[model samples]
Target: YAGPLLEEEALNKAAEKGLSSPEFLELCVWLGSQIKSLCNMEESITSTDGGKDVESFQLEVSSFLREMACPYSSLISGDIKDRLREKEDCLKLLLFLSTELQALKILNSKKMKGSHLEKHNEVYQEVQTICDALGLSNSSASDILPLLTNVEQKIKDILSKVQNNHVGKSLLTKPLNSEQVERLGKINDALRSEYECRRRMLVKRLDVTVQSFGWSDRAKVKTDDIARIYQPKRYALSPKSTVTLAHLLAAREDLSKIIRTSSGSTRENTACAINKV
Candidate 1:
């Protein structure tokens, strides 16, 4: 019976012993799902010669879950308590993944020139919103903000898959357990710290590069300014979402080419900005 084909005799024997054992209730819930797979769902409840008693078994398991939810009546509504009976731990994890995927979509929409900082802000807000609403520990906004992604298409794919799994309206997503929440928090923290360290080094490199291109004090762009100008958007926003700078840059209009002819100083500043990256 454990394999694909269930022998009539073996199934009958299992039904007899299983119904009388301490694990009878658990067996009933499993049997319902198994019956759903089998061709004879109706016959399962009707006593068959092999020894399966389907009707009483289904009733007993349904009552067991209902009784387990009884003590919390004062706090939880009847509808919610019933749903808790069927919900599994994995369902909550899927729900969290769905939320983050949505956040990624929001970040992807913000990809553009000079919008990296703003994108970081929004992604951070989304992450914090989930954490707060779900009673997850509040993480550092600045540190988490940089984790956002701008990859729209990839996240769209993932979100689509997750949504497909969220079929029913009934399976309640329990608040992420403490361990799961903390693990995600630590991941965000570690990633943000790593990104911050990388940005610092890049800024230093940018400073050196800018100084070498000096025309005048105003002509030399700061590394931080360069990052604002050319550092990849995904790298810029962290702990919030992921998006690459190149992808957004390609989609942006080439406005620099349209700027009118200017005086020497103006030309130099504009040239520096355009050529640094």
Candidate 2:
């Protein structure tokens, strides 16, 4: 199939829609894992286009096409690009989704032997059957799908052994998609932007306050030190910086006060508050 070039406008469109679809997220995660697998390998597997004797190249490609079909659309759409650049949360989500997808791949690898592993194995077999039936077993497709089921099942067993068993639960229950992840990226970006603006305003206020106290800009008055004076663990309490949060809170409070005070007075104390506080 012909793929579209990942144009800026297409990327913008994907970003605007936001990855709100759970299917999309799952698809992205799968693609990521497959790409990683394709990129990394033992030296022997790298030289030949993966085993040449097992099956006809066209047949192998066709078998892998089913798995490959979903992700290429997103790549062409540029959904992953914007989502990746958004924030830590998106990265975490992407990684989590990818882990689940890899788990699915592992599950598809091993043949059905145990009762618990039966369903997953069946799915893998079914996918292979479908590929054969659909005439998609071509050499042009990657070989990932034939083994995807077994790989994903094995990963499931490993995940079940984790201390935080919630990983499996979340993967099994969460219905997130590409559109949703894209939406999350937007939300994160908005928060980041707001936080940055407030942070900068607070920094400016702090600088003016220090200057008003007859301290030169060269005289370093670390915000952490200021917060520590108030409470020793103030900054340590949260994973992030309390001093930064405090500055933003104070800046907001000061703004509210100035707005109230400036309602009737033309010569407002806004400057004084910024400089003297």
| Model 2 regions more than 4 Å off | 1-44, 47-185, 211-261, 264-277
What TM-score do all the candidates reach, one by one?
0.20, 0.22
**Candidate 2, which ten residues in sequence have the lowest lDDT sum?**
40-49
Please state the error at residue 75 of candidate 1 in Å: 52
Q: What's the lDDT for residue 241 in model 1?
A: 35
Clashes of each: 15, 47
TM accuracy, model 2: 0.22
After TM-score superposition, what is the CA distance of residue 248 in candidate 1 from its true location, in Å?
21
Per-residue lDDT over 199-243 for candidate 2, one digit per residue giving the tens place of the 0 to 100 score? 777766665664465444543555446544634533333322233
Q: Could you give candidate 1's per-residue lDDT for residues 1-277 as a string of tens digits?
A: 1442146454344434443432333433444344334322333222222555543543433343333332333213444323323323212222332343455445555565339888867777866665555445555547773333323433455568786544323222344567976776777667767877887777677667756755566646565675566557535544333433223333333433455568676777667654667
